[model samples]
Target: MPRLEPGQPAPAWNLPTADGGRLSLSDLAGRKVVVYVYPAAMTPGCTTQACDFRDNEAVFAQHGYAVVGVSPDPVEKLATFVEKESLTFPLVSDEGKEMLTAYGAYGEKQNYGRTVVGVIRSTFVLDEEGKVEVAKYNVRAKGHVASLAKQLGISL
Candidate 1:
C-alpha cells in the first residue's frame, strides 16, 4: 500500500471499540477527526502519547475535532489501557490490522535496533469532509501531541 498523503481521502475503516461498539471513519464525517495509530497499548511511549491526547482533549474538541486512538489490540486490552490512563477518547480495537493496512500504518518498524513488522506510529488529521489535512507518519510516540498542537496553532 502507498503511504497516505495530505489532500488524499483518508481510507475509511471500521473497528470494534473498547465499549463493544463499532467505530467507522465514515461515521465521523462532517467533523474533523484525529486518528492516532499506535503500535500497542500499555507501552510506555504509547501511554505517554495517549495521555497527552487525553490531557489536551478539550482543546481538540474546542476546535471541533474528535480524537480516536487505534492499535492492534483486543477490546479488553484497550479497555484496560483506557481505565489505567483515564483516557476519555475512543480506543478503537484494530486486532486484525485491516484498518492499519488500509491506512498504511502497519509496516516495518525499528524496535530495539531490530527491524520488525509492526504498526508504525502515525497520526492523520482529517478535515470535516474526510479529506486528509495532515498525514504524519513514522512519528515518535512521545511528544507527538505537543508537536501536532503546535503545528495546528492550538494554544494547548
Candidate 2:
C-alpha cells in the first residue's frame, strides 16, 4: 500500500454503507470528510473506537465534517454494529477491501505476537476539496477521537 501524506488528494471509492446505501467519494466532494478505517466490526478495540466517534459526532458535524467508518465486514454486520452502538454516522462495508487498499488502510501487522496482514486502524481528514488535511495511521483505539478533536480544535 502506498502511504498517503497530508495535502494529497484522497482516492476515490464507492462502497456500501451499513444502511444499505451506496457512498461514493464524489458524494463527499464538497464536504469535509473524516474517513476512519478499522480492521473489523464488533471487536472491543473497534467498538471503542467507533463509540468515541459516535459520542463526538455532533462536534464533528459542527466542525463541518462528515464521519464515515470503513471495515471489511459485510453491510449486514456493519448494520448490526451501528444499531448496537447507536452510531449515527455512516459505516461503510469494505468487504472487498478495495477502499481499504486505496486508502492504505489494509496491510501487514503484528497481532498477538504473530505477524499478519490485516487492516490497520487509521483516520483521514479531508477538506471540502477532497485534499487530505490529516492522516493518522496505526492509531490506538483509546481516546483517539478525542485526540483528533483536540487536533482539530473542536471543544467537546
Candidate 3:
C-alpha cells in the first residue's frame, strides 16, 4: 500500500490502549495528532523512540498536538512497555495490523541490507480536521521525535 499523502484524510482507527482504554481518530477530531507506528513493544529501538516522545510530551502539548504510538503488540505487552518506560502518551495495540496497513505503515522494507516484509517504521501528523499534514515512512527510531519537533517548528 502506498503511504498516505498530506491533505488526505487519515484512516479511522479505534484501538485498545495501554491504559485499558480505547482511542480513535474521531475522538481526536478537533486536535492535531501524531500517530507513530513501530514494529514492536519493549524492543531497544522502540523503547528509545517511545521514550523520546514521552520525554518531549510537554513540547508536543504546547504545540497543541497529541501523540500516540501504534504497534502489533497486544494490549498486555503495550501496557507493560508504557509502565516500564513511563510513557505519557497512549501506546495502541494493533494486533490485527488493520490500522497499520490502512496508514501504509506495514509492508516491505529494507532491514539490515535485506528486503523484508514487516512493520515499516512510519509517522503521520494529522491536522485539526483529521487530514494528514505530514507523512513519513521508513523513519529511524532514534531521534525521530526530535526531528519531528524541528519539522513542526517546536524549539528544542
- Whole-model Cα lDDT of every candidate shown, in order: 0.92, 0.91, 0.93
Q: Could you give candidate 2's per-residue lDDT for residues 1-156 as a string of tens digits?
A: 697799999999999889998998899899999999988899999999999999889989998999999999999999999899999899988888988888888888778899889998999999999999999999999989989989999987
Q: Which candidate achieves the best TM-score against the true structure?
A: 3
Looking at model 3, the pairs that clash are: none
lDDT tens digits, residue span 1-156, model 1: 478888999988888998889999889999999999998899999999999999999999998999999999999999999999999999999888988988889988788999989899999999998999999889997789989989887888
Q: TM-score for each prediction?
A: 0.96, 0.96, 0.98
Q: Write the per-residue lDDT of candidate 3 for residues 42-126, one digit (tens) a residue.
A: 8999999999999999989999999999999999999899888889998899999999999999988898999998999999999
Q: Give residue 81's error in model 3 in angstroms.
A: 0.4
Q: What ranking of all candidate models by lDDT puts the best one first?
A: 3, 1, 2
Model 1 root mean square deviation, Cα atoms: 1.0
Record all residue pairs in model 2 with backbone atoms less than 3 Å apart, i.e. clashing.
none
Worst 10-residue stretch by lDDT in candidate 2? 102-111
Q: Order the candidate numbers by TM-score, best to worst.
A: 3, 2, 1
In model 2, the runs with Cα more than 4 Å from the true position are: none
